[model samples]
Target: MSKHWKKLPWIIAGILVLIGLLNPPLLPWILLILVSAAYWFLPRRGLIGPVTLPADDAFLPSQQVQWWYWTGHLFTDDGRRFGFEVVFFSFDAFVIMRDQLVQAAITDVNGQRFEFEEFLRLHLPKRVKDGFDLSSGAGNQVTAVGGDGHDRLHAQIGNYTLDLKLDSTQQPALHYGGDAHPYRFGGYTYYYSRPKMATTGTLTIDGQTFQVTGNSWFDRQYGELFQAIRQGWQWFAIELEDNRQIMLFDFKGNDSSVEKSGSITDANGLTTTLAAHEFEVTVTGEWTSPNTGCTYPSGWEIVVKGEKFTVEPLVKDQELRANHDLWIGPVYWEGACGVGGAVAGQAYVELNGYCKCLAAKLP
Candidate 1:
């Protein structure tokens, strides 16, 4: 039990003793009310516990914050290419209500266009044993019903419909936090990733269907992280041609300090944690969003283990501007990118906290 919890029982005991001395007849009723309240308020064992290797894939609704994220690069048979992103988020607000959100986007690389959609609702669909089936509106859904490596994703926005199946090609990469203890950025975070997944499916644009195949990255994180995301973060998931997959995170605190952490998984499913000194990242360019007036890093030159990679967004403007009624216009950048230099590959980068307005709205 936490230090706060350790003292709670003592305080409650004192209250009961005082009530018994003052009014013996009412003590039993008061004790019954307290017991009932504890049963309803406290989280159960499995819902809040230490994260182990091969972390559980089920949705943790009791957690303060959690998300399932996917990003990939797809190719068409006729020489066209595209990039896609789909993410589901679940969070509890002030211990009062639960909120669910889904965000989907597609980058038409050949068409030089980027389109996205999002929906926020009060409740989420029930999840089954270690799996989830979530849908917000018509033609937007993400389901992984079997808890197996095979998963299906479907989303449609504008004139594009992205329907893909992802199968894990390697074992799950348990992050350093999961290797031993949970990561502590804003709070205790249990994080894991399925770095390399074989992707195959169809993408429809303007009623023209095309068969596509590619690779994808899956990320799952849940914790008491309500304050962690508000500060800022730069996350990258890269898959190189040599079958080496990497996941990197740079979390920015309120005092302008950056904490760096990463993990590299080889072709044989062996993962090695990367310390802060093992890698470096430099900003190569910047782009200002015309819609939200937020200036974001446009390009990056990241180096790890003496190997350098240049990453730039497939399209210059892949920013998502969210204007939901429940939120105060949170704006951020998450997009598909191309990698070059020591080894060629594809990547997805997420940049958050670029807009100061979000912080200003927070109490």
Candidate 2:
């Protein structure tokens, strides 16, 4: 027991003794004191203990804030390409809290899209086993980093199904404080990312199954409370042909100025930290979403070490209008891209909070 807890009984006894000495409603004071002490001392066993890892990398489940995120880009043997995101979010809020939500989506360069989101409340259909796998009844979603440190994922929505196996060639990239220091991002989450994972699996779209092989990204963030409303971020992940992975995040302030940071993990699993002012991101063009009229940065010209790179989307309309509570709870654009210039690679870009604090803009 903590020192504070050890003194609790003495404190309660002292209060009761004082009330009896004063001779003021002894019976009521005794009853109230006993009830309060019992309530305070009662054990509130939880599913998880002290955080063994930050929100992004966990060895055990969290009772507070948690989410399992997986996103990837794959190509068929015939050069047809696709992208997908399977995520499960769980957190508790004093109010305005939905227990959990499973969001899954798949997109193709040919303009085919499929998305499934289900809001869960009191009886949210989900299970977190060993803090590594998350299984949800929402569209049969599962995102797990198994003992071998590979991601096994599956999701089905109508005629669209994403079944992929992701093997981590590099160690996890810790973006912020790990378990020892969990004060970042509202003191809730320790964040990390698997910038690139070698992926192979079957993707069924519109009843057509295709064998695909490509790279994907995995991000995990969990904590007691992730108060992201302070502002949002522009997240980028790039995987070079040489197996080098680069990731950058521009955390935006209310006025839109960005705080740039991220990491670069080499092919050999060595990570070089990128601090603020180490890099810059600039938009080369914009795309106005026909669905919500939200203008998003379409083409990007990102610069690092005085070298510039240009990236273009596989499709201009990769915006996910997840207006429902079951999804990201925000309107944002997440898509695969073709990178050129300084690095030849495939990339993924996520743009959020452009219209407001996390997808508040709508038609």
Candidate 3:
């Protein structure tokens, strides 16, 4: 039975019992109220419990396994653009983005068509500081990383669809952090992997196939409240021409106070956390969104401790605004960056919502 459907019987039974106990000849209305309260307040016992995995599971190495994510943005051209993101241990994943009033379709690896239509909406029991708890919308995502060294993915959201295969031969470096000197994000997130994935497949949009050849960055983080409202960040994941990679992020809060920021991983999985002043991020350009009327930092200048590198945008206008909202997310100026003020390698810099101001708080 579906998870949501299973809750219906208990809810109906509670309502019926309350009605019966409220009769005129009953002991009292207060007694009925107390009984109802007991039904609602009793501890949940049975199969429901926190999810757990064995420590030595084979799939434990990949953080992407059995995880769900949401990347939503409101694009002006469409109104609302949302994608359901999921990565499986098998390397199969999918991303589906679409707007209302449209029908989308999903095409699998073999070019098969599947109707992708569904919506899952639920209200929050409490309000959030930045935004309402809102609902976790409806979507479908499936991925599998095969033992033969290949990744497959399929996703469906509204009328959009995304299916592709990623080459797994190019393994990513792994890194681990502990609470003593944990990742700057605050929570315990198993961070690892390559900064880029060479993708070779087709990305179909509304029945049209666009040949795709691009690099994708994959990150998996699971923890409670990894970031606070006061903390603004600037992040960069650069792929160098020398086949090396650089990943860094800095968190800054009020009074220009540096909370915590640094490069957590290097090319070969060796880890290091740079001091606040060891790295710097300077915005070189800005772009304003016509939809949300919000301006985003479009260009940047990055200096990494003793290492020297520069990054620029390939497509600065890569703005996604759908569902009558605006999300000026980073698409980036990525390419081979000169490292150590001499060597060159692939580089990409991301200036998040903080581009509006140093102390800008996100909504």
Candidate 4:
């Protein structure tokens, strides 16, 4: 047995003796040890038998890819707005490891991008005690609150001199794995978010200054297993004209099966979940990337059950393929979407990892 396992008996015996001396509960302590030993050494009755059912091979891969991610949009009292996106990607194999990237940009109606980048390094805290209450309701759940009375975050890239605060008033609704059926891909993820936030700050990019004012969106997702060869995904978070919010993600598989995914959060904080079969998202336009020699779906026609919407590209050639070998880097799309039965609002779309070389596809 390992050193830790060999010491277990001695440690338990010592604890029993100490407790017996402190109080006249020696009989109870002795009985506890007997029961613990039976559970530890017994075969079928042991505590390590199995808690969860052994997942099939198809499900095991996703179980291994787990991480924590959170992204939120903040809106200030004035017209100024900021967006906060944070993620902690984790893995088990040496080839796979925990990777984190955060991106924050300020854009105005004038088409200026003031951005800041930071890489997360520290571990998330374990518990919160004393004077601490988790900020919940709307869809926001407090995952970790440091003892120092503030959430901790690290910056990896971009501007070095930047400071910001977390606003609890704008917390979104809380939807846990229990609230909805677990999203099954390769593994499972406990995803949640604090959708809208208000950020007040000035970001200067490349010696240019732009004042930012708008609403932001935050998303948090952590799981062990994720698909590697999936063609691409298109995600949309739109704040509609009637103050309702909608989020849509469409994942395309290699077999040409489009997994239409999305969620609708009403103003009353209730969520109407949408699955792949329940929605229709189609690419209406295409942009070929000269850098990667791949074609991307630049425009889209999105029609949810009982609702119709369209997405048009703001910048069709917004591909970062040269820097990153992925086609879903960054682009802008602005279009109007009709929600529910009547209200129509302007929407934005973000597409990532949409292109793979023809050679990459050929055997």
- Every candidate's lDDT: 0.78, 0.67, 0.40, 0.43
Q: Residue-pair clashes per candidate, as listed?
A: 0, 5, 30, 35
C-alpha TM-score for every candidate: 0.83, 0.75, 0.54, 0.56
Better of 3 and 4 by TM-score: 4
What local lDDT does model 4 show for residue 128?
A: 24
What is the per-residue lDDT of model 3 for residues 11-49, given as tens digits with 9 covering 90 to 100? Answer: 765666576667645546645665676567643322212
lDDT of 4 by residue, 16-121 (tens): 7677777776868686776777567633310111112111101122233433333433334454443434333333342234332223322232233333332332
User: Residue 319 in candidate 3 has what lDDT?
Assistant: 34
Candidate number achieving the greatest TM-score relative to the actual structure: 1
Itemize residue pairs with steric clashes in candidate 2.
55-190, 55-221, 55-222, 56-220, 331-359
Kindly indicate the candidate among 1 and 4 with the higher lDDT: 1
Off by over 4 Å in 4: 1-88, 94-98, 101-109, 112-171, 174-185, 206-211, 228-231, 254-258, 320-348, 357-363
lDDT head-to-head 2 vs 3, winner: 2
Whichever of 3 and 4 has more lDDT, that candidate is 4
TM-score order, best first, reads: 1, 2, 4, 3
